[model samples]
Target: MRLSMPWFVRLAVIVVFATGLQAAPAPALAGSDQPPGMIAAVVARVRDSVMRIVVVHPPEAPPGEKTMAKAGEGHPVTRIGSGFVIDPDGLVATNRHVVENATAIFVATPDGGRFRAEIVGMPHKADIALLRIHTGYKLPAIKWGNSDALRPGDTVIAIGSPFGFDNTVTAGIVSSVNRDIMETPFDDYIQTDAAINHGNSGGPLFNINGEVVGMNSVLYAPGTYSGSVGLGFAIPSNDLRFVLSRLEEYGQVRAGMLPFRTQSVTAMMAEAIGSPAPGGALIAALGPRGDEMNGLIQPGDVIRTFNGEVVTDPRDLARKAARAPIGSTVRLGICRSGTIMAVNVPILAYDPHPQPIQEPGPPPKMLGLQFSAAEGSDGTIRGVAVSAIDPTGSAADSGLQTGDIILRVQQQPISTPEQARAALQARAAAKQPYAAVLVERNEKRTWIPVALPGE
Candidate 1:
């Protein structure tokens, strides 16, 4: 028989075992020298609104079999992601892909309370979705920050569940602003090195002041395992606000169109056009439906401003046009033939499948380059192919080489030498200083501003 141990001895043994098993103290946070407790304070302010999203999909059917499952009868395919509440009534914002094709959705808050969620609306083009849950009590909402005010190197915080770890906090600076990932036409991602991963999609990217400035969405990883490699992208809160407003008003986001294709002005093109610097968007082509503004605005015109806002590049014009109110008249400041002109055009709903306009007549040869009809592989005339270039002339000085096909001059198509000559003569008659020429070289197309002779 063994003797029983004293109460003090038993207590001492329990304490020793518990102390030995205790987890090692967490490491101090890196990358910042904030006063003690600053991070904890910020986290406390917004952590309650951060949430984890769970999506359940119906089971897959057998090969080539149209197997349909009864209510809740199929095997559940589960997906996990993150989201944040933007309204006290249980409205949540998340990535569209997270809830796409989901049979059931659920939201889990920080306090371990879970609720069923329903999709309010999702704009596929923007990759943003809104969800609503019926929480008995009002939930905390995050405050929106001005994304436009963000600059490169500004401190930012990313909050989400990475690899199923709930409420993981990562801090990094803004790697870049106005990043275009090319995933969609409305791409204007805020890039940061905030350790975003697969499950981080739809989580809030906070500014230093605990305000939501972006929504973490995409990670740039190119291997079998998709993990953050210090390159992550987020949707700007400004754009998100616009999408949310449209979703609330019309149940869908509406994109307005300018009905024209544009290119960025190069320094050479600007000098040729008599502009002081390389700025503004050069109109390349207009859609057939854009003919309503044919007389007011023409191809080859440089758009300098839209609705009193300066447009420094093609992307800027596109973004402004997309955000414009449909059917509202807007003013455009255009530079045509080195002269400034104003035109008002009514914005129309964007046409996803716009009809192509008829190609214009042949371009004129103001520069010392001879052009002939180019033959395509199918023996069809594609454009005016360069036959000869005068070595001492403007064409040679502007970098036009032999075999460079003259596609268009001032946005007018060219097929024969005579048409090109006529187009040049028209510019000469108008006393224009130069002509913007579109040339195809080695299958690549570019715009070259050829200075007019005797300008």
Candidate 2:
């Protein structure tokens, strides 16, 4: 017969098992239980100070019509983007493209009040601009977070107008730091996937603590009508702050610029340039003449370092070069003609004169045709020769090619780059949908259609 256990013993065993299970702690909550961190508090404190900007645009003139206004004059145009208040006096920061040609700029606050704003200054090379709004109302201003402290995978929040939706919040992680996708002199961009869009330009990208770390800018994609494909870029707060301080002090951006045009090299191309291994940066060209006459450096030189930063590629060199202060002597480790050497070059302040990034008066919308002035020689083609065409640009789609000299635009003699701009302006005023340019490629001249920006 089995021995019967006492009822008290049985109860004791059950109690011991139950006590062991209860000793295990419940799962901790997702957020810190005590309180939101200082960072979160910081972010919440500045959310309302941001603004959505709306600008009015002027209609384009007709073709063959003398400009009612002089060349390089302003026309009214409508633009929409986002910005954040930076001062109690209503200073705001935004992207240059947002107010590039604004006749009038207005900012609408989250509280539904609107105020007129003035463009304080703009830096074309840096792609940054500053504006001031005199609302006479106290507005919240955001505190800037240090961009140097940012790391990949850090949580970030982007608040902006996406597709005209105001104050939309999208969360994401910092995809990258110090990205140099564009050829801008100052190109330290913060890559994120925070759902940026058409109306998001100039808006702030915040860290979890809500401090502004970057200014949302471009999307990496083709075509005018496209959505974010998880690739969005921002101007780091470090750079934005630098530009802002300079603008407030100098009324323009004053930064160092190298006198050279560079092309990024891949591993394969690095080898072609005679790099010891398949990894390094190369100088593609010196500046377009005047500035290049200084002749401190030459093309085909492999740059190993700049200003103490390791230069892995052309972009790295550009990023470091741009960040160096103007009037400073920058140390460069260069490899030329299979020989390594060190040189110090004085960096110049960024050229403030807006040299047309593209050919001046070239149609706003690029057809992707690049033309150059002809040389002084008989039997040489004259006028605007299509030296290169962008495969993805409108001209490439239209079958334009290299060595093609454009003689006429819309039946107007296109003798020079200035003439080309005038012809395009006239055609645009005429309400002509497109301007036909006469081109000579391979000694055969024919007419090609060029599209204007607003058309």
Worst lDDT 10-window in candidate 2: 8-17
Residue 41 of model 2 has an lDDT of: 62
Report, for every candidate in turn, its global Cα lDDT versus the true structure. Answer: 0.73, 0.66
Q: Per-candidate TM vs. native? A: 0.67, 0.61
Q: How do the residues 237-278 of candidate 2 rate in per-residue lDDT, one tens digit apiece? A: 987887898787877766667776766567777667666654
Candidate 1 lDDT, tens digit per residue, 1-455? 01122210100000011123332222233236566666668888898899988665545677897645332233334567889998998999987777776555668899966666777767656667888888789999999999999988777888887656689888777889988655654567898877776678789999888999999887776544455567888889998888877766666777787888778799999877765568888888887777766567777889999989998787778778889988888999989888888999988787554332211112223355666788889999887877765432333335466677887889898878788778876876777646788889989999976645444
lDDT leader: 1
Give me the runs in candidate 2 sitting further than 4 Å from their true place: 1-43, 59-78, 183-185, 220-225, 265-280, 289-296, 352-455
